[model samples]
Target: MSYQFEELFADIQKDNRKVLDDIEPFEHPLVVLLRKCLEEQEYMLDRLIEEFEEGKTELKDIKTNCSALFHANQKVNPYFAEWKRATGWIGYKDDTPSEELMKSLEERLDEMQDDLIEIAAKLDEEYGESTTKYFIPTFYLPEERVN
Candidate 1:
């Protein structure tokens, strides 16, 4: 069953000083519980990472598909064509993507990328620039108990 992690953690943090001050150095129940909760959180965090990876893959596929479609329709509307990387040339005489549609798609893609960056920032403030995971926890942690 699911646990009220926030409440449990908060309550322990509030009583952290007392627990450490009064209890023996041996394994305390609160410490044990908090450790278990953190382990469970690790699993949840792993899932979040997996989902982010999936989203990034999906975004790449969408960008590739858009480029292919634009290239395919370039035969009818050269003005709406994009630069071709392979041939070092601009669009062909394409008609599939009208100027308006291309503009809209570009705008939508930009928005989608922006959204992805925002989510990445939440998972990692530097967005993979730093070595650490940089995940901000949802719950406060109890301080270490010393002998």
Candidate 2:
């Protein structure tokens, strides 16, 4: 099947609407909190990719960035780590999470997704849809996929 940008965009828009609806009415700080979390995630992810592509993916650098991103995210929204543990989003790790922690993480992910959508929209406007192209190719294995 052919790729469908319109469908993906529509899905993102729907998610944005749901995120707005689900947020607590008086939780005004969530907007900025989520924004910071998303921004850090985006920045760190970009750096991680650049270092990896340049054959400089040192464990120390990776760990440093990962820990910094995690801590920064926790500062703004502690729920991110909790949600990852609760939802098994930790991937290949076997860490048990409490119910309260899971709930908090779920809330943070919901908020963070909205902030990501906003950032993506801004990037798209500035750099065109090609902005997404920067990340997509990195998602695949170089040996298995054509450039």
Candidate 3:
């Protein structure tokens, strides 16, 4: 069965909740800042959904934008791996994304990552807590090679 974008989004949210629960207490300012960043991501996803349903944007367009966002995340800094993981939920049953769509998605993701990095850096500077270290790397090599 093919999952709709909304369904995929729901899954991402569920995973995000799990991550939040695992973190708990959120004593660190960096953790608080990361939560805020997640909130912004939720807002952006909601906007994408609204735009798609309203016909302001097509599904392909949305997919393209999402792909760009992921690509950008990889390029700017690998620290925001969780964000990249969230985007992976956006996939189709066919398991094949158009090149054009992929390019657009990469671009959008890159831009979003920049915004997130800036937020993280500013939060660290202002709040005096560096939480960037907590971000788990989203990409991994084969177990045989690393371990």
Candidate 4:
């Protein structure tokens, strides 16, 4: 979310051309863009995971009945549904959060999904379905890309 498409792409083009070009010689720019976006999401999720592990937030009280978790989960559910439709990716057990803090993190991830889905749509439109078949790691592709 902190990164912008044009700026990030330009940074990649300016800095990592050799590395990217070497690995994905014929890769479309959109594919490179999507990869970076997913990487950003990965970093965000890693932070959340670290926090959860460190007990930085009190997330164990599930029976307290907070609507925040429900609303956040609701917001994130549809994003995963769309992601499954778009990529045939399923990440249920690995991605679901255990408590309230996770639910909020899921909402944040849902917001980040917009950039990813937009780039994917553009990739599909410009280069066809073949180019849309890029890999999204399980970490970032939580049960719903944030569960």
Candidate 5:
């Protein structure tokens, strides 16, 4: 695990460290759900790392996988920031991200086409075809993205 991961885990465990319980909620359910998903993912990571350290779970080829995961995580940060800015999720400051940022963001999204397609399919299945018109956006999340 990276030091950044460890630091995040430590903050969650430490009584004196900051907590996010007091943070105000966003107006939109989409933004709120996104934040919740990210938070849950972090918590899962913390648990996985803790289990690995406790000898309760085994890591598969840690040197290779963790390094790859770390590199992927690093690349994800800037793309996520750009996506949030473009979507106006972060704040009122970024009404529009730059053209370069949009291209970079789109490239990252393109990399996840298979996953996006699967998710879209599942969403369509669960919510019905008509529900997708409101929930599954194809303009930003292209239908051509399907693998």
Candidate 6:
């Protein structure tokens, strides 16, 4: 997760601007994918919060998990806000985008995972080692499960 700040800044400055004086930002194809990704992520977060609430978990535990999820998801918040602005003009569309589009979206999402790792590492390096866990927990794959 060796993050090059220049690379990310360049991505942000890509040619995705509003055509009209007060329009949205869907010029970048990645925005389409990001909108859907945000929805799915929010849905999952809702489910997790509901599960914890149903278990009669302590308030602190619920807050901790929910806050963690929100903070991690907010890493992509800027893109989500951009898509929402676009939707305000064009409403909700796209039940199914092209196969090629979907593939591109998947690739972008993979890149996002790398970005998350890099961000975590950067925070740890600048602040303290404990900062990484504060941002994101150590994840385990299905094969790595103790059970």
Question: Which 10-residue window of candidate 4 scores lowest in summed lDDT?
Answer: 61-70
- What are the per-residue Cα lDDT tens digits for candidate 6 across 1-147? 212432432232221111111122334554645544454454544544355445543434433543354454554546644544554466455542344543444455455455445544443454455433453445411223213
Query: Model 1: runs farther than 4 Å from truth?
Result: 1-94, 126-147
**lDDT of each residue in 1-50, candidate 2, tens digit only:** 00122233234334434433443232334444654555565566555445
lDDT of 3: 0.42
Question: Backbone collision count in every prediction?
Answer: 10, 0, 13, 0, 0, 0
Name the runs in model 3 displaced over 4 angstroms.
1-3, 21-24, 52-147
Q: Give the better candidate number (1 or 6) by TM-score.
A: 6
Error of 6 at 112 (Å): 1.3
For model 5, the run of ten residues with the poorest summed lDDT: 15-24
Q: Lowest summed-lDDT stretch of 10 residues in model 6?
A: 13-22
C-alpha local distance difference test of each model: 0.31, 0.43, 0.42, 0.35, 0.40, 0.42
TM-score of every model? 0.27, 0.34, 0.36, 0.26, 0.31, 0.37
Q: Model 1 residue 142 lDDT?
A: 17
Query: Whose lDDT is higher: candidate 1's or candidate 3's?
Result: 3
Where does the lowest 10-residue lDDT sum fall in candidate 2?
A: 1-10
Lowest lDDT 10-residue stretch of candidate 3: 133-142
Residue pairs of candidate 5 with colliding backbone atoms:
none
lDDT of 2 at 101: 45
Judged by lDDT relative to the true structure, which candidate is superior, 1 or 2?
2
Candidate 3 TM-score, true structure as reference: 0.36
